[model samples]
Target: MARMPLAERRRQLTEAAIRAMTRDGVSRTTTRSIAAEAGVSLSVFHYCFDSKQALLESVLTMITDHYIAVVKEAIRPRATLRETVRAGFQAYWDHVAARPAEHMLTYDLTQYALREPGFEHLARRQYELYCETYAQLLEQLGRQTGFELLVPVPVLARYLAAMTDGVTLNFLVLGDADAAAGILDMVTDHVAGLIRER
Candidate 1:
């Protein structure tokens, strides 16, 4: 393989680990498997990441980033804040529908992290990352639309994070697109109500 920067290689390996874990599960996926999935050798994998914990952290971050990027792109200000938020949720739903396995893998990763010794922090960090992502999105929306949230940024962010996690889990378990859309609509209205227009 051609030479690459350490950061790039680590990202490549992390993505590979995601795919491998999604396919074979976190418990089953080994460093050898991740290396093979990334088309790198075992030594290369170790060079990039010292342990599987690091890889798991990278994978969780990567997963969170995938949907957050979509939501950010879709969250541009529309005619109304409600419409803009709806667009963002729609974008997220579209992503989940298209990549169900990847989303499912996130929950699996969470369970695995929680059960694994000394890895509980990873699961905690995962939720923290979710809330942080939501906070940034809320901040971005505020900037774009010049609206104030009745709730503090941190509180609203955690609320959004919890609601989203529940909705995603509900959709994954039930596979009811219509119900999911309704839940999204209810959430959109609730979230919009929290905003104070400038």
Candidate 2:
């Protein structure tokens, strides 16, 4: 392969690290494994990241970015708030279904971050990013639908994030896609109810 820019190289390494972690588990993954997965030399890995923790942090950020883009693309302005909310949730479910390994890796990374002393902040920031992304989406939906939210957007966003985390964990553990989706639909309904008709 041709030489890549520093930013592109970093992205490549981050993706490779995620693939390694997904396949080998966080405890088994190492800088050498990530470098081999990326088809780069060990020196390249060191040049791109300060350490394994830094690379994992990049992986977390990448997952967050991917999820936000998926949800944003899934949600569009619709005639009714209910339809808009359902579409967004369905789109997210589809994304998770298509990339179960990547999604599972995210959860694993979260646990790893929490257990590792220096990385606890990454776990906290990951949830914060989730909340902020949802809050922005909810605020925009409210404005577009011309429906006042029963609760503050930020509060609703935090609730949605926490609820989804639980639902996702259960689904991952039980391998029950249908049940997980049903719960998401219920969440959509609840969110729709929060918006009064104009």
Question: How many pairs collide in each candidate, listed in order?
Answer: 0, 0
The ten-residue window of minimal lDDT in model 1 covers 159-168
Model 2 steric clash total: 0
lDDT of each: 0.93, 0.86
Q: For candidate 1, lDDT tens digit of each residue in 59-175?
A: 998888989999999999898889999999999999999999899999998999999999999999999999999999999999999998999999989988898889899999999
What is the per-residue lDDT of model 2 for residues 125-173, given as tens digits with 9 covering 90 to 100?
A: 8899889989988877777777788888889999999988888788878
Clashing pairs in 1: none
